[model samples]
Target: MINLHWVILLPIILGTIVKLISIKTAKKIMVLFQSALLISATMIFIEVRKNGTVLENIGGWPDTIGITLRADLLASVMVLLTCFLFLAMIIFVHNKNYADHLFFFLFLSLESLIIGIFLSNDLFNIFVLIEAATLIITVLIMYKKANVAIYDGMMYLLINVVAMSFFLMGLGMLYKKIGVLDFYALETALSQVKDPQSLILPYAFMITAVSLKAALMPLFSWLPKAHGTPSAPSVVSAILSGLYVKTGIYVFLRLQIAFSPLIDTSELFVILGLITAIVGFILALAQKDIKLLLAYSTVSQIGVIMIGINLDNPMAYWGGLYHLMNHAIFKSTLFLTAGMIISEYQTRNLAEINGVFKHMPAVGVATILSILGIIGAPLFNGSISKYLIASGSSGTWIESGLILVNLGTIIVFIKYGQLLFGSSGKKETADSDILEKAVVLTLSMLCFLGGIFGSELIAILFNVKLTVDRLSYSIKILLFIGSIFLGILIYRGLFKKTNRLAFITSFELGFNEICLSITLFFAFMVAYLKLTL
Candidate 1:
């Protein structure tokens, strides 16, 4: 039995060696390594499922003194997802020119860093891994070196660095107060403390940083630029939207658990999430670039996931977790398809490109399936997750907020669906490679199959059985249908006529402004925590 620790280390070690080899050799090695990694991750996940949470202390030292690697169901599931996604990504980009040795090296290193973040039981180790991943992603986003990609990369780097500095300060405070960096030890130590309120400053610092990382409202200015940068490879954009952002959400979830004894900020997060969702889609509705539209949609989905998890409802929590995975599949598919569309049309503007369905039927089908998934159409994955979240919050404002957000999502996608029809005067571009189509098709099928077996999937993934609420499900289906019509009318009446609000859509916060926003957010969180205490 291979130790779980080595799973995280092997990728980094192999990636380094592959970097020195020829590009062709590196590609072959990466494919094999990623395949093996997926199998190994699956084995680890199975072992954890059978044996319960697995733990290892590095160097044979005790948990309190040594670095601790742990894999609970959450960590194992995320690791498995990461492995599968990275392998799919490798396949997706195989025929593309971006498969040079340096790209693969950074890509594999990123996989290792993400795995490390999920598995690390030490808070400090998580911090370090996140920082390393941030640096790597910065380089990847700007690899093409065109059209403000450098500025986007630099902004991404600087903002995250500032956020991590806050995290480090919080880590320092945590160590000073609890005398341990290990999560288990910190929990025990925090429970014994007489004044839990004293931990508020550290909690505020860490969560503020996490909020930025998660791209919450007011701090999400960097997300569109980074994810939609003209120069970033489609696979990079997909990976960023699909997996990397989830790391922030994952850390946010962990932080909430770790700090639960100190504070219950669930209500605050719920409100913040609702705001993020509303703002995100509104911005998305105003975008002309296809990639930016998808990017902003990601911000909205992240917010919805946030709200679902923080609702303090178990069913909603499970739904939120499931949605995280679903968003990854559908959103990545959208980005990849959009990349192909942009490449073929020689333009990113949705208004100019037309007749994708006629020109590229397979890509069109994938795009439609993904659109169904995103809009919570009755038999898609989004419906299952959204239904679960709604059922968990019957008659609450949160439910209403969710509906509004869903409506906004529909409006944006309805506009996006415009790219699928009409006539393109130009001839069709080269057909997408077989592997590219396969990747999108597979994800689209998962979205369908997931909804078909939604209940069973939830039970299998989270070990929790849930009965379907038939009436609620019917109502949700009805609402979704209504929203589709409403979205079309709204788009035809308003969005089609005006480019008003173009400024808000194009406006980006400068570094100084972003820093100020972070500072203000930290202050607000601190104040809120004090008042509640």
Candidate 2:
């Protein structure tokens, strides 16, 4: 059996070796190495499923005394996701001129750090991995050094550094209280502690950092700048939005579990998630830059995923996890295809580019499919997970909130749909990469297949069996169609002729303002814990 640690380390080693080779040779080597890495990740996942969670302590030390590499179901599945996304992205950029050996070195190094985050069981180890990944991603975001790339990269770095400090403070507090850095060990020790109140401040400090990383409302000011930077490569943007932001949520889930005995703030998170979803779409609806629009959409989708996880319902929990995977697929397709369209049209302004279906039919098809998936069209992957989430929210105001969020999502994308119509008046070119088009189209198809087989996918992904209610599903289909028409009307009536919400686009938060929000969030969590727990 392949060791999980190798899956974490081989990428850095291969990246170093590839960096010394010529570009042509490097591409070839990276292709082979990434494919093998994907296979290793899959085998680890299979091993986890068959034999239960796999754990190996560093240097033959006991689990509580030494650093541990662990691969539970969630960790293994996330590792599988990491490998798959990296492989797809590698192929997507394989033939590009800018994807030089240096780029591959940094790319593969980031991959190793992300996989390490998934496998690490120690709080300190996870923090170190996140810090390393942050620096690499900043370099990637400023890779082209165009426009305000440097400023954006610096802002991203500073904000995350401050956020991670909170995480470190919380980690230190946790270690002091429980005398363990391993998550399971902390959980056990916390269970026997006399005072549950001692963990409240640590929870507040840690969750504030995680929420910001997850791009929750008010704390998400950095996401649009980082993910939508004009100079970043399309592949870099795709992976950051698709896979990177997800790491925060993944860590939040793990830590929340460890702290479950003393704290249950699911209700508070549910409210916060709803606010994030609403704010995300409102801002997304105001964007004119194509990539910025997609970036804000990522924020909105993250909110929906957060809502699902915190709903305190098993169906919604799985729905949230499934939606996380589904969002990665469709969002990556959107970013990659948006890059292609921007290159062809030589613009990122949504109004300036049109006739995608007429000029670049393949890219248009992929974009349309992805749009459908994101808006939760009845038969797309999003619809299934959203339906499950809706099912879990049945008979509650949360259900109504979900409807509002879905409606806003519909309106936002309907405005985006304009890119697929009208004429851009640019002559069609024959220079587009066939492999790039194929990768996106394949992901788009996965969106459809995932929805069609939603129940089966849920079972396979999480080992949970669920049967969708036929009558409820029928109602959902009707609601989806109705939302589309309503969205079209709203887009035309309110957004098309007037700049009613254009002011939203000008809204920006400075470093101090963002820091204030983080402080407020931490204080709020502390208050909530004091009152609730």
Instruction: Report, for all candidates in order, the number of backbone clashes.
Output: 0, 0
Give one digit per residue, the lDDT tens place, for model 2 in 399-479.
999999999999999888899999868676436798898899898999999999999988877778988999999999999
lDDT tens digits by residue: candidate 1, 275-322: 999999999998999999999999999999999899988889999999
Worst 10 contiguous positions by lDDT, candidate 1: 499-508
Which residue pairs in candidate 2 collide?
A: none
Error of 2 at 171 (Å): 0.9
Clashes of 1: 0
Alpha carbon deviation, residue 464, candidate 1 (Å): 1.4
Flag regions of model 1 displaced more than 4 Å: none
Tell me the RMSD of model 2 versus the true structure: 1.0
Q: What is the C-alpha local distance difference test score of each model? A: 0.89, 0.91
lDDT of 1 at 57: 89
Give all TM-scores, in the order shown.
0.98, 0.99
TM-score, cand. 2 vs. native: 0.99
